[model samples]
Target chain A: MLLPYLLLGAILFVLGLIGFVTRRNLIIMFLCTEMMFQGIILNLVAFGRYPLKGAPTFDGQVFALFLIAVAAAEAALALALVVLLYRYQGTLDANAYRMLKDE
Target chain B: MPPHPISLSALLPELILLVAGCAVLLLGVATTAHRRRLAPWVTLLALVTAVVVVLFEVLITGRATRPPAAGSGLFYGSLATFVRIAALELGVLLVLVNWSAGREEERGEFLALLLFALTGLLLVAPADNLWLLFLAVELVSIPTYVLVVLSRSNAAALEAGTKYFYLGALSAAVFAYGLSFLYGVSGTASLAATTRAVVLALRDPNSLQGGLAMVGIVLSLGGLLFKIAAVPLHFYVADVYQGASSPVAGLLGFVPKLAGLIAIFKIIALTGFWDTENRAVYWLLWLLAVASMTVGNVLALRQTNIKRLLAYSGVAHAGYMLVGVLAGPLAGKALATDGVSILGNGPAAVLFYIVIYGLANLGAFAVLGLLRTRGGPCETLRDVAGLLRREPGLALLLALAMFTLMGLPPTPGFWGKFALFGSALTASRLTGDTWLIVLVIIAVLNSALAAAYYLRVIAAVLLYENDQPAYAAPREAQSIGALLCGFLILIFTFYPSGLMRAGQHATRELSEPRATAARTESPVASAVDPPFASP
Candidate 1:
C-alpha cells in the first residue's frame, strides 16, 4: 500500500534530477531543484504517515515542515540571484555564463 | 529524548554570533560612519567572545570529559570545543582577509553574512540532528553563494555566483533526498538513533533493504562531495575560486570543506563507523581518495590562473584529508605498540591538516590580493613571476606557502601529511586491510605529483622576473593577515607537538563512545519490539 507513495516520490525525484541536468535556462534549472525538494517532502510525509514498522510519529513531518521553510528561503535567494544575473548578462541561458571557466 | 538535544548554554556562543549578525544589519541602518567603523568590530568581537566561551567550557567546566547524554542530537565533547574554536579563530582571520574588500557601503552585509556562515559552520560539529545538519550545511552554502557575487562587481563573479547557486541547490536536493531515504529506513531523524538502524542494515547486507539503507549514506556523501570539492562534484571549485575576489576565495578554500568533512565524519563516527565488514564503504572512500587526488593534480598542472590553481590544489588537499578519514579514528590505546599511535588517529589528523591548509591558503591568497598585474588583479602565472625583485618580503611569504603545500619536510604541512598517511598505514596493518596500504601508496605518489604544480608557484615567484608587475595600492591589513599565517606556520613547524597533542586530545572521546557501542554488537537486539521505539 505504501509502495505507491515511495515510487511516486522516487519518480518525481529522478525526473527533477534529469531536468536539472538537461535544462539550460537558469530559472528552469532552479525550478527543477524545487521539484526535487518537493519529491523529498512527499517522501518524508508519506514515510511519516506509514512508517516501516512502528506507530506513526511526527519526526518526518517536522522535518518536512523545516524543509518547506528552507525551500522558501532558497527560492527567495534564488530569485534574487536570478534577477541579478539577468541584469549583467541580459540572458538566463546557463550557457551565457561560461566566461568564468577554462578554455 | 525528553532532554532537549540543544541546551541554551551549549549554543550560547552561536547565539551571540547570530544576534551580532542581525545587529550588524541594524547598525548598517544607523549611519555610514557607524557601519564603517563598527561592523567588523562587532563581527570580530562576537567571534573572539565565542572563542573565549568555548575555551572556558572545555577548560574550566570540563565539557570535554562529560558523557554525552547519548541520544541527544548534540555531542558534548572536546571535539565540539576544538572545532568551534578553530572555526571562530579562522573566522577572525577571515575578517582580516576581508577587512577592506568589496564596496565600503555594503561591508556591513558582507561581514554579517560571514558571521552567519561561520555560525552555520560552528553548528555542524554538535548538530547530530538530521534536520539541523542539513540546514547548517545549507546555511553555510546560501550565504557563500551571495558572498561570491558581493566580493566583486564583475560579470565573472556574477557568473560564478550563478553556477555555484544552481549546482549548490541541486546538491542540496540530492542530499535531502538521500536523507529522506535514511529517515525512512530508520524511522527517525536523530543521527544517534539511526545508528542502531544503520547497524541492523549493515548486519543484513544480503537483503535488498540493506542496499537501500546504505544508499542514504552514499548519496548524502555524494552531495557533500560538492562542498569539499571532491571528485565527481568538484567541477565548480576552479570557476568559483577564480571568479571570486582573493579573500573570499581563501574563505571558500577552508570553511565549507571543513564543515562537509566534519559532518560526514559525525555521521560515520556516530554510526559505530563504516567498520571492516563494510568493504563497499571502504572502497567508495578509497575510490574517492584516489580519484580526487589524481584529478585535482592533473587539472591543476596546466592552469595559468593563480586562483584556479589554488582551487585545484584545494581539491587535491581534500583528497589527502580523505585518507585520514578513510582510516577512521584510532579505536583505543590497546592498538599502540609505541609512538605509532599517531598512525591510527584519522579524525584528528584531518582536523589538524585542514586548519594548516587553511592558514597556508589564506597567506597565499592574501599575498595575491596585495598585488595586481596590468590587465587585472593577479590572475596568471606571469603576474607573480619575478616578485622577489619587486617585493622580497611578500615573495618569500608566498614561497613559504608553496613549500608547505608541497609538504616539504621542514613545514607544518609535512606533519599534517605525515599524520594522514601514517594513519592509513597503521589502519592497514591493524585490520590486515591491504586496500588501505594501496590507498597509502596512491596518496604518497599523488603527493609527489602534487609537488610539480605547487613548485611552479614557488619557481614563478623566485625565478622569472616580470618587468612590469603591477602593484595594487598597498593593502596593509591583508598583508598583515598573510604575515600572520606565515608566522603561525613557522612557529608550528618548529613546535608542532602542542598542536598534534591537541588534535589527539580532541578526538579522544570522539572515538571512545562509538568504540564501546560497537563492541556491544547488540544494539538492535537490546531494543524492545517495534524496532525504533520513539520515546
Candidate 2:
C-alpha cells in the first residue's frame, strides 16, 4: 500500500536534484530545493499514515511541519540574497558572478 | 517516558545567548548612535556569561549535580557540555576578531547574527532528537549566509552569498528528505528509538526496511559532508572565503565544520552502523577522506591568493579530520587484540584536532584581516612581500601560524596531527584493515605535500622583498588576539595533556549511549514497544 507513495516521493526528490544541478538561475535553484522539500513532506505524511507499528502516530507529520517552517525561513533568506546579488551584478544568472574563481 | 520534562537550567547558556542576541538587535533600534559601541561589548558579555555557565555545568557543579530532569533527552551528556564550551570560546574569539571590522551602522546586526549562530551551535551539540538537529543545523547556517553577504556590499560578496545559499539550501533539502526516510522506516525521530529500530531491521540485511535505511544514511551523510566542506561539495569554499571579509571567513572556516563533525559523530554512534552488515558506509567515508585531502592539497599548490590558498588548506584539514572519523570505534569486539583497544580514540583525536586547527586557522585569518590596503584586504602572496622587514611583529605572527598549519614541530598542529594519524594507525592495526593503512599513508603524504604551500606563504613574508609601501599598522586589539592565538599554539605543544584529557572525557561520554544501546538491543523488546512513544 505504501510502495507507490514512496516511489512518487523518490521520483520527486530525484527531479528536484536534477533541476537544482542543471538550472543556472538563482531563484530557480532555490525553487528546486523547495520542490525537494515538498517531496519529503509528502513522504513524511505518507509514513505518518502507515507507520510500522499498530497505530499510526503523528511524529512524521510533526517533523514535516518543522521542515516546512525551516524551508520557509530558508526561502526568505534565499530571495533576499538573490535580490542583493541582482542589485550588485545587474543579472540573476549564476554564470555572471564568477569573479572569485581561479583564473 | 512521557517526554522527560524540559529543564531550563540545563539549557542556560543557549537561553542566555538567545536573549543577548535579541537584546543587541533591540538596542540597535533604540539607540542608533551608540549601537556600534554597545553591540560587541554586549555580545562579549553574553559569550563570557555563557562560558561561565558552561564551566559551572561541566567543571564546578558537575553533570551529576544537575537535577534529574536536566540529565535526559535534550540536555544530557558531558560531550554536549564540552562542545558547547568549545563553541562558546570560539565565538568569543570570533567576536574579538570582528570587533573593529565592518561599518559602525551594521555592527549590532553583525554581533547579533554571530550570537544567534553561537546559540545554534550550542543547541546542536546537545540536540537529542532528529528534529532538533535539523533545526539547529539551519539556525547555524542561515545566519552565516547573511554574515557572508553583509561582510561587504560588493558584487563578489553577493555572488559568494548566492552560491553558498543555493548549495546550502539544497543540502538542507537532501538532509530533510533523508530524515523522512529514516523516520518512515523507524516510525520515530528520537535517536535511541531509531537506533533500536534500525538495528533490528538491519539484522536481516536483504529486507526492504534495511535497504531504505541504508539510503537514508548515505543521503543524510551527503548533506552533512557539504557542511564539513568535503570533496564534491567543497567547490564553493574558495570563492566564498575570498569574497567574505577575513573575520567572517575565519568563523565560517571552523564553527560550522566543528558543529557538523560533532553531529556526524553523534549520528554514527547512535546508528551503530559500523557493527552492522552495512560496511559500504565505511568505504564511502574512506574515499571522501582520501579525496578531500588529495584534491585540497593538489589544487592549493597553484593558488596565488592567500585567502583561496587557506580555504583549500581548510578543506585538506577536513580530510584529515575525516580520517579520525574513519577510525571511530566499530560495534563488535572481534577487532580487539591483546586488550589494547584503539577503536575509541578517533573521536577524542578529532576533538583535540579541532581546537588546534581552530586556533591556527583563525589566527592566520586575523593576521590577514590586519594587513589591509586602501583598496581592500591584502590577499595575494605578492601583497605580503617584505612583510618581515616592514612589520616584524605581524610577520613573525603570520610565520608562526603558517608553520603551525604545516604541522611543524613545537606547535600544537604537530601534536594534533600526531594524535589524529596515530589514531588512524591504531584503528588500522586493530582492525587489520589494509585499506585504512593505505588511507593513513595517503594522509601522511598529503600532509607533506601541504607543507610546500604553507612554506611558500611563510617565505613570501620572511624572504621576499617588495618596494610596495608599508602595509597599514593593525589595530592593537586585533594584533593582541592574533598574538594570543599564536602563543597558545606554541604553548600547547609542550603541554598537550590537558587538552587530550578533556578530549578523552568528552569522547567517553559521547560513546556511552551507543554502548548501552548495544547491550539492550533485545529483539523482543524493540519489536513489541515503540520506544519513542509518549506514555
Give the Cα lDDT of each candidate. 0.81, 0.79
User: Per-residue lDDT of B353-392 in model 1, one digit per residue for the tens?
Assistant: 9889998998888888888788578868888898998888
Interface C-alpha root-mean-square deviation of candidate 1: 5.1
Docking class of 1: medium
Give the C-alpha miss distance for residue A83 in model 2, angstroms.
1.7
Cand. 1 TM to true fold: 0.94
Give the residue spans of candidate 1 off by over 4 A: B4-6, B65-72, B274-276, B331-333, B336-340, B515-535
Native interface contact recovery, all models: 0.59, 0.62
Stretches of candidate 2 exceeding 4 Å from the true structure: B64-73, B274-278, B330-344, B515-535
lDDT per residue as tens, model 2, B1-535: 2324556777888999999999988876665576558877899899999898878766666562244341134645667777887888878888888887556677777789888988888878767667778888888998898888888767788778878888898888887887787777787666667787777766676888888777787788888888889997899999999999887888888788987897788667555755552577788889999999999999899999999999999889999999988887442133333423334477777888988888888888888888865556788998888888878887898898888889997788888888788777776776677887898899999999999999999999999988872375548767777777777777788888677767766766554566434322332222334433432
TM-score of chain A of 1: 0.96
lDDT of 1 by residue, A14-84 (tens): 99999988999888888888889998999998877777756666778878999999889889988998898
Query: Against the true structure, whose TM-score is highest?
Result: 1
